[model samples]
Target: MHQNPSMADIKVIIPAFNEGDSITKVIEEVPDFVSEIIVVNNNSTDDTFEKAKKAGATVLTETRKGYGHACLCGLHYIDKRSKTPDIVVFIDGDYSDYPEDMEKVVAPILNENIDFVVGARKKELREPGAMTPQQVFGNWLATFLMRLFFAAKYTDLGPFRAIKYKKLKELQMEDKTYGWTVEMQLKALRKKLTYKEVPVRYKKRIGVSKVSGTVKGTIFAGVKILGWIFKYSIR
Candidate 1:
């Protein structure tokens, strides 16, 4: 890895699953201020790895095929590296997030020395019909319960978030399925980590979504996320 003298250092970790169509574009859209980009290919059936490599992102393959599994594999790679990162930014590979605003997401942690940052999305920011009714209701119900249980404030369980690498590791993130984002948020609150929210834009993705697409998928994902939130919030 090359060093930047300008002092703007960050590592972007993208977990991709069958996102070959837009992964390359997303990689290209990421701000160059980021020192490193690690893309974890979560058992993609397409050419996600090839496209990411073509876009100059360091790529690794995670055969287990879950969002949390892919992220954990990437984190393990980072942990094993000689030079660790100052911050770790987790973004989806589907290009729903505005890659340019990555600076905004990482700035609070970088400047104020905050421990973690979540990219919150307002209703207007979301693509029309981007979130299913179940998703919206699930977020509200889960977040309400979280606040009630742990007295912690949370706006969105967005996947587009960043955290200090050290503090992130200390949380011992263990979610291996669809509940990854919520698990991180609940654990961070329980651990009393300094976290902030930055409003971000969301767009329609290039391909189909695994969750929020089918009735079963939506219910299962919402149940898993809510279950994880309650499990940690009570602890």
Candidate 2:
């Protein structure tokens, strides 16, 4: 069994876009084992950058206004560091996920040598009205399609996930928008990486969701996610 992660080189990357109201709480709740908390401000028109920095996290700016872009910017920042972390955890700054549960999310990777882990947001564990109807349907359709096409076993494309840094590098992720989460899962399947899903609690976010809250955002996200699935299915 993994004794403890306190000595492990673990880092967290949170992608924030106008999550000023929740970013600080998200940062503060992270487990102590995390060596560094990197919050990528995705061109937030609010005080996301200031709040994240004030919370004692390493803040980076990605003016591209995309989830993937912000995550990529965080990865680039880590790449420049002299010492690379052993594990990288990706979480959203919206505070929907319980940051304290990160240890459970990373346990499989640390103990069983799992290459990737997804924090499955089971319906029983989610707060009421935490996920929009579009979000729920989108997750079901996307995971079902992935299973049908790739024989994968994923329940949700939850943003709360952990992966070995080296395996993550091997994925060569390129999505710059809403397709980021699905792209990572698809790539993991293609690479035949050992993976697992751990149940995690989800709650309502502090601010409006940028993707699932608006009509255009919902449609665009649906298209992007489906587009990635089909594109990978054909390959």
Candidate 3:
């Protein structure tokens, strides 16, 4: 087992919407050395907030109802704190990602001082049906555009990512919906932040994905992602 680095101040932010069933498992699996786990309950009608709090997470509520909105809320919460963490990690509330591999996701930043690290869900590491066909095609299309436009090496806009808190703030992230992940990557490229990808395991999530499972959600997400890519490409 790789030991957690004691010196690094790491905080994890989870944006959840009606993820009560899988929130606790996600929190419980987080490595112990993490300084804090902040679960942003994104207007979940269910008991997501309660379950996360019960699991010992510092839960916050974001009534705005967007993935970026919830993540921004967590960032605001951290910004208000007297002691800022060295690194911030963003992961899903669903149990699709292996929380235990957080150590690996943050390793490049912790050891090599990389500005950002993305936990790439490589095909070999992902379980069957873990990603929908739309999700797969979307990732491929987005990354291909990124490579063509910016000479970026990003393969997946995976949410399980880590970045230095200072660099993250420097990016001035403003996406409030499906474009959040790609916006970060594009901005990181624009700012010339050193980044690395670490292949990680992925499993089927406990519940249906709010974004990829529904037709409307998938279409909106695709449009938003493509919009960001084109907007940045022209700049």
Candidate 4:
């Protein structure tokens, strides 16, 4: 069993795109045990950056508009930090995820020697219409494909996740779009990393989802997710 480390070393990375209304709430709800909160504003045309900064989160700007790009920007900032965190958590800035449940998300890693954990937004725990039909279908299809191809047991491609900083670097994540979450899961499988999922609560976001709220965003996301799965399956 891994030594239970102080939760103080935990850092949070929130990939925000135009989440002006919800960023502050998201940042504030994060548990006090966390060390640093990093929010990557993905070319927002609103006051997202200013609000996040004012909310006491270390904010960075990623002009390139993609979830993965914003996440990569946050990771890059952490890479330059002098003291590396023991665990890094990724949550959305849209306030859809319960930030307080972070303790549960990182528990296995801190106590069970697990290398990674993804917050599974259980259908029962999610608010009505929290996840679009396409999102639900896409998650099922992607995870089903992973199981069929790799015998991997995964349920949700949830954004609220935790991973050891060292193991995260080992994955060499490179997805710059919708493929981000699946790419991490796929690479973790390829590396045979110990992982688990903890159920997390989900609610409707404060603003319209750029991806699930629009037809174009939904189609692109579906294609990107499928493309990643097929590409890795062939490897």
Candidate 5:
């Protein structure tokens, strides 16, 4: 929080996977204050790429087919830019999150000089069926473990989050799959970065969830999340 950046330098990165049905809506809803919207298509078999581009977003493709891979691709693109962004906000492409709420997501970094901010989909604000039972349990378990092991105060591993660009690179984020979100949170804690959570509204996604909608996905995600938590605990 040493530097205060203008809203024009705030950029957004969205990782989309077969989200053609909701890509445009997600892109359109992002606040006008954002400087650029970069969408990384995660090997989508649908028209997510074309639609996002048509919606006037800078679109890139990552054929690795993982959430973390897509996010890393977007970060790579920004790193090579002539003028890097001051802040980077990440959101899902499924349209489950309120894109307009990005103002609050990035507010901590912008207004209060906080290092990181996550949009907590508070239970009261989440629509019925927006989160699967497994997802709820997984988030609870992950945050609970972090609190127990590190005295951390995180509530949810929510995807809608904002972070200082420099702080993000300092994390050296490497998880290329289900463990991405938790990896960021844990690294932030280990590094002792200032962070906060803002409750945000959530709704049902336009299409089925790739991770939470299937047994395999749910199990893999759970294992990855817990693995990160335990590994950090031992350290």
Candidate 6:
């Protein structure tokens, strides 16, 4: 049904908010072989859009603020009225994820025909204090529950991930909050989609984090993520 030959033909979707400083760097690192790059500027107070546009990235704005909401906007753009790449790679605008590794993540999906892929950042590779104690425990509990209830296996719920566009659309993704990553993994598990994980180096992101810095943010994220996983299991 699609003519694109390999994952290189995929589009890179980066969700950014107030990342004016590092957006250009991430975009520049993306291999030239990529078909299209869309940066969803989620109501950035700074000149995020201008900088991304100048870097030759197709910039779109989502007034509402939320990681999942911004990505939903990007997906709508890609699904409804765009080139419709064979695969879609989601990367954060913070430049924490190595852009050069995009090829590494997508290769499994293209060559071996994996349905979706996640860039698993092992605990050993994660930087000191990169994950709060609460974060680490929450991830373990959540992944355990996912394996127990959904029978899914994933090490880290990292934002750096890739999936076939067709499978992505099949998921009918609806999370508009911090739980988006977990939600996607649960769906992939429930659907029994072929999945793979690759070793991706993790580093501190530019600027302060949005969800992990505050007590309220951390607790709310933990609650939302756990709630989504179980809620789907009952359905």
TM of each candidate vs. truth: 0.94, 0.99, 0.98, 0.97, 0.97, 0.93
For residues 1-235, what per-residue lDDT tens digits would candidate 3 score against the true structure?
3435567899999999999999999999999889999999999999999999999999999999899999999999999999999999999999999999998999888778799999999999999999999999999999999999999999999999999999999999898988999999999999999999999999999999999999999999999999999998888
lDDT of each: 0.86, 0.95, 0.95, 0.93, 0.94, 0.86
lDDT of 3 at 121: 97
Clashes of 1: 0
lDDT of 2 by residue, 66-162 (tens): 9999999999999899999999999999999999999999999889989999999999999999999999999999999999999999999999999
Candidates in descending lDDT order: 2, 3, 5, 4, 6, 1
lDDT of candidate 5 over 36-112, digit per residue (tens): 99999999999999999999999999999889999999999999999998899999999999998988888788878
For every model shown, the clashing-pair count is: 0, 0, 0, 0, 0, 0
lDDT (tens digit, per residue) of candidate 4 on 1-235: 5544454499999999999999999999999889899999999999999999999999999999999999999999999999999899999999999998988999898888899999998999999999999889989999999999989889999999999999999999999988899999999999999999999999999999988999999999999998989998898
The lDDT of model 4 is 0.93
User: Considering summed lDDT, which 10 consecutive residues are worst modelled in model 4?
Assistant: 1-10
lDDT winner between 1 and 5, please give it. Answer: 5
How large is the C-alpha RMSD of every model relative to the true structure? Answer: 3.0, 0.7, 1.6, 1.4, 1.8, 2.6
Relative to the true structure, candidate 5 has a C-alpha RMSD (angstroms) of 1.8
Off by over 4 Å in 1: 1-8
User: How does model 4 score by TM-score?
Assistant: 0.97
What is the per-residue lDDT of model 6 for residues 1-235, given as tens digits with 9 covering 90 to 100? 3223342568989999899989999999997778889999999999889999999999999998888999999999987764688889999998778888888888888778899999987878778767677777888898888878866778788899999999999888998878889989988887888999998877778886778878888888998898998798789
Q: Report the C-alpha lDDT of model 1 over 1-235, residue by residue, as the tens digit.
A: 3333137557889999899999988999988788889999999889998999989999999999778999999999999988998888999998888998888888787678789999987788899977677778887888788778877678788889999898999899888889999888888987899989899999877787888877877878888997897677556
